[model samples]
Target: MKAIITVLGRDKPGIIFHVSEILYKVNANIVDLDQTVLEDKFFSMILVADIDEINCDYNDLKDKMDQLGKKINLQIKVQQEDIFNAMYSV
Candidate 1:
């Protein structure tokens, strides 16, 4: 399985490190990633992760990411690629 992970918040140090740490803990392999700052304050990232061998289920991973987001004062979300595509498809 694959998942789309998004993070958005004020730009800060260690954001990528913390996020990547969580993914690493779960053994989620990052396949693609794009991140940038907007107006010097908004930090946004989108990543495609291979979750085939992830240690936890989809919802569990999402929950963990959510908690991490809360701890870091960012907004983070994880969704299965298929569902994300379906929701955004025209």
Candidate 2:
């Protein structure tokens, strides 16, 4: 299923490379990405990637990502695109 991974943290050189490398390693297809640095302390990135190739269950992916986030010192989250979109439905 399609999903979106959101990352936010301090802006630093190689932040994109580090994060995108992980995503690419996990076989995620990056469909879209938007990134920005606010001031000098906070930076954010929103990536929409297709993860239909993930072999395990969604829960497993979430756990792996939790570890990834902790490793990188960034707040990260993954959500099914439909669920995320529904949350904003009106």
Candidate 3:
């Protein structure tokens, strides 16, 4: 399965490293990523990952992402690709 992970918060140096680390631990392979700092202050990112080989279930990944976000002061969201697409489709 595929998933989309979105992150947003104040710009920081290790956001990508930290977020990717969590996914790595769960064996979620990053297929694509896009990030940018808005007005040189806020950080935003959208990452697409392949989760078919993840070591744990989706909830586990969400929990891990949530924990990391709390630790680093960011807003992180994880959604199955299908759900994400559905939510945005009109």
Candidate 4:
């Protein structure tokens, strides 16, 4: 399964490293990614990852990412690609 992951927070170091580390631990293959700092302070990132080979279910990964986000003071969201598209589509 492919999923979309988004992160938002104040600009700082190690955000990408930590986010990627979590995905790596779950064996998620990042297929596409884009990130930027807005106004030189707000950081935002969006990525698509393949999670079909992961051992754990989506909820487990979401919980882990949620914890990581809280720990790092960031807002993180994970959603299946189809659901994401449906929610955003006109």
- TM for every model, in the order presented, reads 0.91, 0.82, 0.93, 0.92
Residue 85 in candidate 3 has what lDDT?
75
How would you encode candidate 4's per-residue C-alpha lDDT over 1-90 as one tens digit per residue? 798999998988999999899899989999999999999999999999999998788999999999999999999999899986788898
Model 2 alpha-carbon miss at residue 61, Å? 2.9
Per residue, candidate 1 scores C-alpha lDDT tens digits across 1-90 of 789999999999999899899899999999999999999999999999999999987788998999999998999988789996788898
User: How accurate locally is residue 26 in candidate 4, as Cα lDDT from 0 to 100?
Assistant: 88
- lDDT, candidate 3, residue 44? 98
lDDT of 3 at 47: 99
RMSD of each: 1.5, 1.8, 1.3, 1.4
Q: Where is the poorest 10-residue window by lDDT in model 1?
A: 79-88
Cα TM-score of candidate 2: 0.82
Error of 1 at 90 (Å): 7.8
Q: Higher-TM-score candidate among 1 and 4?
A: 4
lDDT of 3 by residue, 1-90 (tens): 899999999998999999999989999999999999999999999999999999998999999999999999999999889986788897
- Candidate 2 C-alpha lDDT tens digits along 15-86: 678667767777778899998889877989998888888666777767777887888788889888998778
Clashing pairs in 1: none
Clashing pairs in 2: none
Clashing pairs in 4: none
Question: Could you tell me which 10 consecutive residues in candidate 4 have the lowest summed lDDT?
Answer: 79-88
